[model samples]
Every structure is written in structure tokens, then in C-alpha cells.
Target: MVASGDVGVAFAMVCGAGAASSLGASCVFAVKVASPRVLAIALGFAAGVMIYVVFAEILSQNAIDSFQDAGYSGNAAYRLATACFFGGMLATAALEALAPAEVVAVLQSDPHTRDLLRMSIVTGLAIALHNVPEGLATFVGALEDSEVGASIAVAIAIHNIPEGICVAMPIYYATGSKWKAFFWGSLTGLAEPLGGLLGYLVLSKEEPLSFGIVFSLVAGMMVFVSFKELLPSAFRFDAIDRVVSTSVIVGMAVMAASLLLFTL
Candidate 1:
């Protein structure tokens, strides 16, 4: 039941939602200090928010819903979704293992900036990849019904605001440049508009299970990045477990609250 007209308006709607990441990234300027403790909390917060969304939103809700929309039913849909989840994890593991050490070192030559830069880049990439499906969904929703699409787009923009924080804060702490942080954070969101274009023209109509698969894959990639990159970087930057742990909880609370807004 996808209509083909209004491409311009739908594109704009998705772009507006995507830009919220930049809006969130801009918030880093308000923080007063650039310190190891701040970076730790940011990293922990990023991990917590991502981990919560992976379980509570992506895998639990979006993936299943997409599959059911594709005519999958009951436990069969759950089983397929779980399999795709593990497949995503294994794929990320393979890619991480295959990445050359020399390339990694070359990317960030400064010892101080090395791990933090790499981790943030990985986090941004994962988030960006996930946004593709989201963009598609937004475009399709808009094409189906403008009012509902606008409502969903606003909700998505609010949720993305925190994800922007997740991408920018660590980079700001690492490089001490608000511009650099915002640039990278904004880059991650560009995927949304691009995804909207691709989905509207290519995927949304013909491919029903694509969103479900992409959701599971990205959720896996996010969980992997949280444990492998975010948490470890947090511990390395600051030894205070109490602060990191508390920030992690706060991040989860923020993400949960944002997601709950979707239901209302």
C-alpha cells in the first residue's frame, strides 16, 4: 500500500529527523570541562543507552514487528529474529578481527587520541548503519500517512538527540574540538536521509523482511561495540567504577524515557 508521490516532502521529513543528531551533538558545548572522568562517564553512558535500545527496542520490538508485518507469525518469527541477531554478532566479530592493526594505528597517530577516536568512529558507524532502516521506515510511514509520519518523525528525532550525544561527547573529550565532534556526529545522521531515498526508491516496496534483518544486525553490532569499545575505553580513561556505573544507569534511564515517549 505504498504510494509513490510526495517524494520531496517525505525526504524533507526524514532529513529533519536525521538532523536531530547534530542538534544533540551541539549540546556538548555546554559541558564545562574536558577531563578523563567526563570522557569515562560519556563512554559509559553511550554504552548503557545503546545496550538498552538493543534489547528493549530493536530486538524486542522493531525486529519482531517488521517480521510480523512481513507475515511471519508467533514463535517462528522470534526464532528467525534470534538467528539473525547471532548472525549479526558473528559478522561483526569477523570484521573486527579482520581489521588491520596498522590501519588502525595509521588512522589515529596520537597515542592520546588513538583508542578514543577509533571507538567513537566505530560507534558512529554502527549507529549510522542502523539509521538506514529507520530512514526507510520513516519514508514509508510518511508515504502511507503524512500525519502519522510527522508524529513518528518527531519521536525519532527526540530519540536520535541522545544518540547524537553518544557520538559527540567522547569525541569532544578526546579531541577537545566541539566542531570535530559535531561534524562526526552529524555525519552519522546523514545516513537517514540517504536511507530514506534508497528505501523509498528501492527496498521498501519489494523487500518486506529487510527492516527486521537490518534491525537485528545493527542491534548486535551496537551490543558488540558497547562491550568491546565503549566500556573498556571508559574503564581505561577513569578508574572510578562508581561514576562510570552510575552514568551507565543514567544513560539507560534517558534512553528508556525517550523510547517510552513513542508509546504515548
Candidate 2:
């Protein structure tokens, strides 16, 4: 499973496997209906994974590396990391504003047999930008601390699950083919590990700088995904205002707690 070129395939398999697991689990027992409470919990879990990656992996690592600097305190490095993380979040927010409205329009206008071919291309570009640094994070973690790396990898995999579902749901709803929808959804996520591999091959020649750049980009990518995809999707779930607010708050709180506990 950890072999080379398996990065994207691994992500797809992991996410698809989760979907498969759910189906299999349903067979053994009664299907666990995802009520508003359950949806909120799943969102919270995703948030926890995100927050852990941003602080624990990004900030803590930066603080340690900066220890050797003459005037720089670990505290300063930590602060800097926080600033960058938030800054990355802001950058993502900005990009979300630029998300092609045409895509959304098309998705809603005619879900079945909708002309999403162009929108899919745009999605691929956006995902590619997001995947590059994620891949590096996975690779670097695996190399430096296999145990920690494995944890991060698994967390990332968990994070990608909803993402896979998000991609597939629309297409599936439109086209009515679970397999095709799943295929595209899973394929889009492969960019991360693929980017990871490419980043490693290119950046490994220069260690610290490579790590820093990779970390920074990962931060950027997360912010983009959060604002551009996750938050929007959360709101799109039309049920009740209370449900939406509760879900969003839970997501934020979950991320905050995960950062404080795992990273701080």
C-alpha cells in the first residue's frame, strides 16, 4: 500500500474503501442513518484532522527548525507559523471568491446529463494546485518519522473521504452512476500523493527549504479547500438554519480543540 506511484491510487482506494466499508457494514447490521447529529460529528472529525495538521505538523516543526537561529526564539517561530497558517487561510478565502460561478450554475441548472465536462476541467486545475504540497507533507512525514507520518497519512485519508463524497455526490446525482462518480471523485484526490512524489523528487536535493516550502503550500491548500469547498457544501445542505449553524460551529470547535491538544 505504501509503494511508489501508489500515492493517488492509495488515496482513491482509501476513500473508496471507506465507502465500500460503509456499504459492507450496512449489510451486517442496520444502516446507521446520518442524522443532523451524525453529519455534524463527521464534519467535526474532518475539522480535527485539519487543525492537527496545521498546528502540530506545520507550526511545531517550524519551531524546532528555527531553534538554531541566533536571534530567533522557538516562540517567534511558533508565532510566525500561526501567522502563516492564518494567512494561508485568508488566501484560500480569497480564492473561494474566485471559484467559477458557472460551475455552480451548471451543477444546479440540470444535474442529470449536465454539461460538467468543462467544470470538471476547472476542478482538476483547482485540485492540482491543492495537491502539490499535500503530497510533499505525506512524503516528508513518512521519511522523517514513519509513525507520525503514518498517522498524518491516515488523517489526511480521513479528511479526503468527504471530499471524495462531495465530488461524487453532485456527479452521481446528475448522472446516476455511482461508479463513475466515485471514479472521478477518487481520481481528483490522487493529485495529492502525486504532488507529494513530485515535490520529493524535486525538493529533496535541498532539505530545509524544501520542507518549509512544502509546509507553507500545504497550509495554503487546506485553506483553499476549507473555504472553497467544505464551507460551501455545508451551507448547501438545506435543512434548517439551526442545523447549519450547529454543524459549522462544531467544525470550528473541533479544529480548535484538535490544534490546542495535538499541536500546542
Candidate 3:
């Protein structure tokens, strides 16, 4: 059974995750326009942070912790972690394959007002689906260790900001209504909390949750997202190659420094 304190922490962390998307959406009203180059760079940065976290932190931690918990060491734990990681990749790949094709089409289409509303709705749904695993990852991290949870939350929030912009900008351009755009963007974020709730319900029932598998799975999903979604989107603008590359490097540095600070 989950303690009351753990429940509260999960709730708070999910709320924070939801708010990050809203905060990004609010930029629609605050700034008249955002440059594509800037957005692409930001997307690259988010991808970099996620990739580094998955390899340097999440997978390594899972291997170590799982071995300790299982009273095993060396190759056995490493193999288990590796298997779980690929399993996660496979699961996310399946989800991606099953995702609504309309959402992908809408995101790729030129920004026409006639289709913008439909696009916003479809995009929101797609984002909601993506956020579910992210929410679960954040909750699991926090449940295992508060500091780790906080770090994951921050990384996911940073990732969500670009998503918020993607959702809000087209809506605002199409309707000239800031509130509508923000509403849809925030609506997408609400899925995070719902996902957290689902995770809590499922995990609370387990006598001893298999955190190693969970962590590996989450890491794989994140890496898949970074590669399949973020990096491709970032590279869509060919002119900003230098900017995106620099941003990615900076993002990795920042996340690495944050991990170091946490350790210290």
C-alpha cells in the first residue's frame, strides 16, 4: 500500500508536469511570434537532455538498483536491464505505429486556418498519448527518490514546452484567440496527471514493484521519443543546422551539470 505521503508527492509532481505545458502555451500570448529557428534549436536541446538522461542516468541507475535489490551482480543485472530497455523500445514502437495517422498528417500540413482547429484537436490528442508514459516515468522516479523525480520532471517539462508551442501557435494563428489556444494546450497536459493516477493505481497493487524494469522501459521510451519525434522535427529546418547542434551540446552539458550537482 502506498503511504499518504507518497500519494501526495505523486499528485504534486504530476500537477507540476501539467503546468509546464501550460506555462509553455502561455508564451503564445506573451510573444507575438517565435522564430522557427529558435523553436528548432529548443527542440534539439530537449532531445539532447532526454538522450543523455536515459543513458547516463536512468539505465545505469536501474542496473545498479535492480542488482542490489535482486542480490545479483555484474552481467546478470546488466543483461536484465538491457532486455528491459529494448522491450520498452518495442512497446513504444507499437504505440507509435498505432497512433492516429491524422495527427501526423495535421502536424505536417501547411498552416491553413480552415484545418488549424482540427489539427489542434488532433495534435492535442497525440500529445496526451505521449504524455502518459512521461507522467508515469516522473511518478516512478519520485516514488523511488525525490531528487531523481525532480530531475526527470524538469527534463520532461523542458521537453513539453516545445510541444506546447506546437499546439498553441497554430491555434492562435488560425483563430486569433489566445484563450482557445491555451485551453487546448493545457488540455493536452491534463493527460499527464491522468497517467500518473493510472500508474499509482497499478503500482500500488504490486507487493514489490519491479523498479528496474520500469526504469529501463521509461528510458527506452524517452530515447525513442527523442530520436523519432524531437530530432527529426528539429532538423526539419535545414538552415538552422549550426544552431540546433550548439543547442543540443548545451542541453547535454546542462543536464550533466545538474546530475553532478545533485550528486554533490
| Angstrom error at residue 180, model 1 | 13
lDDT tens digits by residue: candidate 1, 176-244: 898999898888788889768875655455555877776666566667756865677578667759688
1-264 per-residue lDDT for model 3 (tens digits): 457797789778877977788877887778554566877777788778878877888888754566557665667778788888888788877777766655434546667758778777777778778788778777777776676677677767766776777688677777888998888877788878886787677567543326667777877887887888777767874354967788778888887897898676
Compare candidates 1 and 3 on TM-score and give the better one. Answer: 3
lDDT for each residue of candidate 2 in 1-264, tens digit (9 for 90 to 100)? 135544444344333323432231122122332343444445444444554555555546642463323244667655655565566566555654555554333435445454665565465345445544455555555544444455445545544554454455555555656676657666666566565566557554555544554455556555455445544544454344446455545555654564456545
Best by lDDT: 3
Pairs in steric clash, model 1: none
The C-alpha lDDT values of all candidates are 0.69, 0.50, 0.74
Displacement of the residue 176 alpha carbon in candidate 1, Å: 17
Candidate 3, residue 198: the lDDT equals: 70
Off by over 4 Å in 1: 1-33, 100-202
- TM-scores, each model vs. reference: 0.57, 0.59, 0.83
- Candidate 3 least-lDDT 10 residues: 202-211
Query: What's the candidate order when arranged by decreasing lDDT?
Result: 3, 1, 2
Error in Å for residue 217 of model 2: 4.0
TM-score preference between candidates 1 and 2, better one: 2
